[model samples]
Target: MLDTQMPTPKPRVIAGESHDWELVIGLEVHAQVATKAKLFSGASTTFGAEPNSNVAFVDAGMPGMLPVINEECVAQAVRTGLGLKAEIHLTSAFDRKNYFYPDLPQGYQISQLYHPIVGEGEVLVELGPNDQGTPTARTVRIERIHLEQDAGKSIHDMDPALSFVDLNRTGVALMEIVSRPDIRGPEEAAAYVTKLRQIMRYLGTCDGNMQNGNLRADVNVSVCRPGQYEKYQETQDFGHLGTRCEIKNMNSLRFIQAAIEVEARRQIAILESGGSVTQETRLYDVEKGETRSMRSKEEAHDYRYFPDPDLLPLDIEQAWVDDLAAHLPELPDAKKARFIGDFGLSDYDASVLTADTTSATFFEAVVAASGNGKASANWVINDLFGRLKKDDREIAESPVSPAQLGGILKLIEAGDISGKIAKDLFEIVYTEGGDPAEIVAARGMKQVTDTGAIERAVDEIIAANPDQVEKARVNPKLAGWFVGQTMKAMGGKANPAEVNRLVGQKLGQ
Candidate 1:
């Protein structure tokens, strides 16, 4: 999927005082592994627990409390690597990244630097419409995926001066997916993260919940001249790309894009003003809509990474990885393609339906129950989804089940009810549950398909609107007014096709 030769869109250039500059962006996403326990402790990994309640002795870094690797966390990391279509290393080791913070009781994070469980990978990011309204795609290269333990939260706003530490999140397993500097624009950066989140959510390796801090990204941005990126690609020189600044711990996608824009502009302004862009870590101030310096960027030597003494290097058989791969569920890309191919769905419809697994499952169930593909897709995407959004409900929390919605679609397909009648039936089924057929039959909501009834209704409409009928006869398109009035006069119970036919016939068209 790594399309190195894929023609990229025009570079996103920021106009400097003298020359234009292009943006080079890379993202390091930290996704919390979906597991029940900490990576190297017996502590609970549950969110919203009481402060310091989920900590075990190992997580607390107590004397003589040795760390124990959680096998499930390792499995989840390997599964994520496979899902990303990356190379999996048979042997990987953990290292102690030395750091000091109040939230980090261990004073050092156990991470992988020398040997990561997952190697390089590629993510195919689907960008939004270009200037020509044509959707473009980019394949971003992933540099590596390393497993690490998360630090606890440092709460600073609780008291007047004193700060508090919440250790509930400490020792939680995380997979740091580092990408190459392949992203060009702010939108592309967001799309890349979105694709990564979607892939991880599909894999079930990570929940991809940004609100709960289940996923966070550290974005590194650098600005260069127009053609410097091509030179860097050819020579593999770091100097070609400008000095990079790291934006730390961005959770929201919107904020990530905004931060990149402001940060890139800040660097461009500094460079244009005859100043050098410093390499440092920065924080995006949401209130100010700008990035502020957090600290100087640290290099590998600053972490003092060394192999963990307590834990041994992990070695797994290739057979185990293969087994995991075999048991993997259908991913988002494959599911989207299948939905398009099997259901004859548009790309947009397939993308919308397959954005999440629950929606896709519900749509498939609707298709199965209704025995109609296009109609089911229309109802699911247009009617059902619109109603769900209006009610501020998720598909999983829908009042109408797939079978019930499918039953409504079946009523329309069988010509038992008109489209207008189906909408009313949908409301009845949504608010007050019942069989759509039974409700339609009990309420006399079936379409009047009888040609005699439709002709009489059309004749009545023509007799009432003498002036409108003259115009409709002269302009066939204006006959739609007669069709609408006739259907309305019949309480929207008339079959639309029969109404149109009778309207055209009576109008001498």
Candidate 2:
């Protein structure tokens, strides 16, 4: 929940010679529902399939074909709604949004306009650079989440003479999550989308893969005067915000940030030049780094939307919704809180683990197997995560498994292996995949815990460096040098604490 007492930040100000401008932004994120088939037909929804092969007759808009809704897709939307902490309408109907595209075989898309499946959710977005290891947070309200069918892709690059239509993406289920015009800047907009994607992925409602077009966004951007946003928030008046331009189908976060900055500047330039910003649709050209007008924006009336006559209004039972609610997983927010409270983890580490479901799951498994949450967390975050990221592998694709990592941490905890020895054991297990204890035993990686052996090693290092040993007696802080030498002389297998103890005893003499 957002703290109401905290003051909202100043509007996103773009300084100008004549005047300062502010930016207002909203996002309509389209997340492809994770279902086996299309929203309205039984067409396969597999990606990278043969072009037009998976599409069904209804998806192709054949003369006699009628749409019969896929119940599973509807359930997925409901699951997503619950994940967003949104309201699920018991009765919602689909409408035909009439439009023409070379790839849209139906010539109109089936979407929810008048009554959507979900309504009025809130997403708590955490702003990051994570300064001081704590992120600032704000609540971005969701206006609605509606289920709709996707349009096909028009491939223009493949044919220079004519464009090619691939209906492979056609008729896939999409959940268009519309947000309130609460975003004040580009970073916030990207964070909003990211938080939404994270939640949906946790729920298994959407894969949230923006690269594969599994997720995309239409960014609504406008620039207003500095204090106008506060007024808009108070009055809930759409007019208080300036004329917004819709930037279509943004997939990358970096590109989204750049597009917002460029578009805001464009609008600022237009306003400063004595021209009003136009309410229009625009395309972001990545290479040119500018937004160009695509077409005039249309109101709902222009689409001539009507209830999809072939399929009746979808009516689901509250009992079913309740069942889904009961099964909802521990979301990122809850999981993060638990990590901080239970494991004694820092806010930053908790956020990093819970950012993705797989990472959290892996961390928990390591904790369970090792019976040492703190050690497991450090190993997971500092060592395993760094290695996995360097290798460019997902958590699921890691060379080290939870059980294997757990065994290594266990050796460290039991004093069977020193931290330095554990690192060596980790490398061996990561590459060879064997028991940590067995590897430590076979390779003599065990820490030398005997006080007598450690004392002998310390005496040798002291005898070898008498001047340094005298300096350590003069300055107790310099005793760490003796500790290091003793550990090195013992092949780094001596317990660090015992080595420190022996070094201090010999130095005091």
Candidate 3:
């Protein structure tokens, strides 16, 4: 129920200095539905499988084979639509898009064109920087979400003179979510994708794995005069919006931004040079950071879209939509607010922990087990997260489990180990998991909390460095060195405050 009739603002364009052109962008994101089977066949949706090993007869378009829709895929699409707050179509039908490709054994892809499954929705994309320097949010309108089958991949590296077709990906279920050209800048566009990915991950509908091609976007780029968008708003003329070119297969955020910028500049140059920007499909080269023409953009008629004859229209009851909505997981924004309010964490901390579902779950577990919110937050953000980044690992793949991490925090809180000693104990727990108490005992990493033991260590250090003591008695600043050495001699386990008190008493002026 978004307001598509709202006046679309015009972007700023400098005159003469820049030919006064505004870049208008829209995105069509193809997210592979997180289901075990293909859209029409029972073939495995696993990646990295041997070529053609995962395809079924229907996927290969064998004669007499009929398409059967996967119920799980339909449920997943509904789940995602609910997460996006989109309107679910009670009755939706599929269509056949006729096209010719070497890898498409069916010669036409089964997709939802005229009647999509999900209707208008809105996504709030963070635009500016967050409190922690992360980006802020911007609201973008969703045009529609349609279910479609993916085409097979064409591999050209198998032979020197010939190419090969891999149908493993053929007929994989995909949700082609289209967005309006409401995004104004490249940063907002990237943030929009990031937010969409986060939502899909939370909904458990899409894995959002860009590297493996589970999620990809097709960018629509157009240029207009600074005030032309306003005029289009008043007239509702699509032509006044200027011709648009589609950039295909943009998998990464960096490449998405770069491709949009380059394509816009290329179009601006053409327009400024008295040439028209051709409406076509183009490919983005990550290495070269440029887009090259693929082919002239095709219209719906070019594909000859027709109602799929083999499959019936999908019909779902309102009760089911209500059930899915009832079970929706705590989304990112809600979880972030809860983390901030319940744990007393800063907004930045909340944002970081809630960015990913696994990280947020892990943090909550550690805090609950340790019963120390602040200390647990510190360990999660500093110790565990630092190691995860250094080793290029994710929170789910951490070597240290939540219980073990909680044990470390508990030991530090109880004064059973000093901060420095606890770091070593953390390493032991991370590299070799076990009872933290046992690790501390095995390594003799107990803190010198007893006043007598700490005083003895401090006195011995002062006696060993008499000249340093004399300097400290006179300057009072040199006592810090003695304190450091005393702690170091005791393997960083001596109580630091007690050491300081003893050192100051020995160096009485």
Candidate 4:
């Protein structure tokens, strides 16, 4: 839980020639609920289906086809609310948001307006480091999380004279998480979205795949005087924060950050020139790096929202919500703290491990198998993660499994294989798939742990390079050369610790 009384961070300001303006941001993230079927239809929700192949009669808005709600979507939304530490309303009703689009076969959307399923929640966003180099965080308060149906795609590029509508996504359930205007800048906005995605993914409520439009954010941006935001917070006045423009369907974090900067500057430019910023919906052009007006922002009244006549008000039991709350998975923040405390990892390392469930699960499995938290973290992060990144693969797709990597670490811990030999064994296991111990034994890769053998190898190097040995006696740092030569002469199978001890002992150091 975050302290509600935490100090409001200083506003992020953009300097104009005459005055500096503060940026006020909020996000309405639409996360498609993880369910097998559409919200009001029996149609499959599988992605990458043939265009319009997944549509049901009701989804296509065919006459005399009544809608039926999918109960799993509701449960997923409630689960997400509990994960975010939000209040779940026992009774929530759906409304019809009337609109017209070729992709919206229903001619309007079914959404929650007057009463949302989830009430106020808070998301703790980490904003990198501050002046003192400590991790800085801000709590972005969620206004509501409401469920709605998604519109289909409008394919305009297929033909010069015609546009096509793909109704595959129509009627899919969406959880629109609305946040207050607490975010101060583009970075905070991006962080807020990322944290939401992380939390939802952990809850298994949403997949958070922005590329496939499983998750998207509609950013609300406005510029105000620096202290005006504080006043708005105190007075609860929307006017204090200037007119906000909604940037629609921001799927990429980089694009979200860039859109905020460009939109804030665009608003700043308008206000500085003695013109009012328009309250409208806009789109960010990736190529031009500019925001263009899409349409005037619609108010609730304009959408003509009313209690959805086709469906009854949804009333769920408190016991069901409690049941979901009890079974919630360990979230990112809690997992991160546990990683820090239980594994003795640094804050950054913990953050990296808990950034996603797959990496976290893999690391824990490695730790469990190897019984070395620090070494497991080092191998998983530096070696395994680096290799995965270089190969452009995810942890689930890695060539080396956690058990295999843990086996390699076990060999190192038991002094069965030197670090250099471990790398060679790792390569063989990764590329050819073999047990580390078996490979080490079969290929004579076992470390030369016997002091006598190490001593003989050291003496040979010392005899072959007497001048170097004398120089090693003069400068202790030169002793490393002897260690390297002895290890190489032993085919890198000698224990590094024993080799160092033998080298220092032979040099009388």
Candidate 5:
């Protein structure tokens, strides 16, 4: 899916006092693996639990308790690597990254440095609209994916006089996905993270709930003068890329964009002022809307990485990887393409429906039950999605089930109820659950499809509007008004196609 030759837009240039500079961006997204237990312990990986309640001996890093690898966690990492079309290392080893922090129960955190689970991969990121509003797609390269253990959370807000450490998240499984500096703009950076989250969610390896800290990203941003990037490309020299400052633990997509803009502007101002940009780690302040230095950036040597002595190197079999690939479900891109080909959906509509696995499953179930792909897609995307947003609900929390929605669409297809009646039925089912057919029958909501009744209604409307009739006879486009008037008179229970037909026949169009 990598399309490096797809003509990219002009670099995102920042105008300086004398020269124009372009932005270079890379992201390190850390996604928590979805598992029932912690990576190295049997502790429950439940969120919102009492502090320290889920801790196990291994999770607490107690003396004489050695780390044990969770087989499911390792499998999840491999599955994620395959989903990204990355190369899986059959033999990989874990290293201890030494760092002293209050939240890290183990003085040395287990991570992969020289050997990682996954190798180079690429992702296609869809970005801004063209002149006609069609999105432009660009490809971003992934450097590697490594498995690591997460540090616990430090709480400083409970009481001003004290700081608390919550070890519930300690030793949890994390997949650090590192990206090459292929992103050229802030929007593209956000899009890359969004796409990675979507893919991981589809694979079921990660829930990708940014609000709950299940997924987070560290963005590396640099600014360089125009035409330097091409030189770097030719010589394969990273020096052509300006000094990059790492922005740590960004969760919100909006905040990611804002932080990138602020950081890039900060670097540009420094370069223009005859000051060399420093290589350091920084934090983005949401309220102040600026970037502040946190600490000096550390290289791999600073972490002092070494193979963990207690654990043996992991060696996976190709047959096992193939089995996992065989079991892999249809991914987002394939599903979107199939929806467009089979269901006659627009690209945008298919993209929206297939962005999340739950939404796509619900949509397909509705289509299967109703046997009307076009109508089913319209209802799910327009009516159901709109109502869910208004109620602040996710599709999983929808009051109306797919079977009920299919029932409503079925009634509309069978000519038992009009579209307007279907809308009323949807509202009823949403507020109070019941069968669509039963509700329609009990409330006498079916359309009057009898030809005699439809003819009579059409005649009355035409007789009442002779001027409109004349206008319609002369101008065929004006006949729509009569059709509208007749449907309005019938309380929206009249079959719309039948009404349009009778109106046209009576008006001699």
Candidate 6:
């Protein structure tokens, strides 16, 4: 059992009220499990396939079909629990959550309710920079992580008169990780979800792709008197908690924050008017920036959860758990520490590099191959990352491979290429992949390392501009002008350090 002591609640600001309020928040993050096949069947889990094409017989709930457990999925869930430092139940059972929807072919979802696989995990979320640029980390306790099958998507935009169901996503495995009502604000909620996504991504259990609906959050929001939470903290009373409204299907971070803010204020208004806040499921209109009621929030009893008849209780041995734990990859925190210690990176740089596993791997590969830690980090974080953002490309989809990038850095380290020339070569590599050395040589973009050659160029520049030379001899500040002119004359292929040296030598400054 993790520590459950809550700190003194801070005051919250109501929209148009004089008295301060406290906004309490909790989140249910539904992360799509990264697996090759659906949870109960052998259907392909690939996204963007034709509708109904990826559905298996069990996924489609065909008559006479029986559900079979995927051992890999179970192992993946256990791996996630271990990563979260949570309690892994040796024997967990699945329950059937009955519901009706056009997207749900079976009219029930196979989920875990009675015995969740993982329990009582804690996530430390780093709230964005404060005014002093220092980040504050807040720990949100995770209640449990339970596995369930995903429903198909109901698309309503294909025709105004008809809605269509795409079963491509049906029966996909999802891990609903529920958090305690520990979040204090919208920013904290977003941070919690982001941190959870990062952990899942690091664990290799979830893709954490919000755009693909692979990762989404349901935000539970409520408000009470400023000091009421402190009372709950001391007493551990759930009744002191105000009624909560659940905002469903919030995928975008901006919209998540907006929905929470709007919903919290709405609750505050209702309570201030002496009307109790209704517990309901609400949908956020991204365009309108408001949340509207969808339906009354259903309780656990409403779902009538019971162990699935077709599936047996999931049981695993301690040895298998221990083996899986031993083979687990270095997680985000460890990787961040290693980056700081091994590569001499600051905490901020380490955080950025380790935010995603792919980017961190790419950075390490470039550093290892090129033997330029700081330089490689700079290029990867600044130049390559900027280009990737501009092109809307992921680090894994970067056109410039780690080897090619390392080769480019090596050329710069060996003084065979200038910084400007290296940048141009990078662009070339990014657009058209090739050997950096060959590209530099083919384009005659090598830096001018010969002192004699550079000296001659500096001399010519000085002879043409006697006035600037005289100014440099007097003030010594005008020497930068000659350096610029020399580099420009060399088609930006001049080594900047050599150019400055040669320019100062010619001007006698």
Better of 1 and 6 by TM-score: 1
> Residue by residue across 58-147, what tens digits does model 3's lDDT show?
999999999988988988998888888899998999999999989899889999998899998988765545456544445688989999
Off by over 4 Å in 3: 1-16, 130-135, 225-241, 459-478, 501-509
Enumerate residue pairs that collide in model 4.
none
Q: TM-scores of all models?
A: 0.97, 0.97, 0.90, 0.97, 0.95, 0.90
lDDT of 2 by residue, 180-213 (tens): 9989899898888889999988999999999999
Per-model clash counts, in order, read 0, 0, 8, 0, 0, 1
Report the Cα lDDT for residue 344, model 4: 92
When 4 and 5 are scored with TM-score, the better candidate is 4
Q: Give the TM-score of candidate 3.
A: 0.90
The C-alpha stretches of model 5 lying farther than 4 A from their native spots are 1-10, 465-481
Tens-place lDDT digits, model 1, residues 1-509: 22234345666989888989999999999999999999998889999988999999889889899988999999999999998889999999999999999999989999999999999988888766668876678889989999999999999999979999998999999999999999998999998989999888888999999999999999999999999999999999989999999999999999999999999999999999899999999999999999999999999999998999998999999999999999999998898878888889887898899898899999999999999888888889998999999989999999999999889988888999988899899999999999999999899999999999889888888998899988877778999998889888888999999998888878888
Better of 1 and 5 by lDDT: 1
lDDT of 5 by residue, 1-509 (tens): 22234455556888888789999999999999999998888888999999988898888889999988999999999999999899999999999999999988889899999999899988877666666665677778889999999989999999999999999999999999999988888988888999999999999999999998999999999999999889887987889999999999999999999999999999999999999999999999999999999999999999999999988999999999999999998988888878988999887788889989999999999998899888888999999999999999999999988899998999888889988888899999999999999999998898999888888888998889999888899999999998898888888888899899988888777
lDDT of 6 by residue, 74-179 (tens): 8889898888889999989999999999999998999999999888888766655555665556777889999999999999999999999989898999999999
Cα RMSD of all models vs. native, in order, equals 1.7, 1.8, 3.8, 1.7, 2.1, 3.4
Candidate 3, clashing residue pairs?
125-137, 125-138, 126-136, 126-137, 127-136, 127-137, 128-136, 130-134
Better of 3 and 5 by TM-score: 5
Regions more than 4 Å wrong, model 1: 1-7
Q: Which parts of model 6 are misplaced by more than 4 Å? A: 1-16, 60-64, 155-168, 505-509
Candidate 4 at residue 9, lDDT? 53
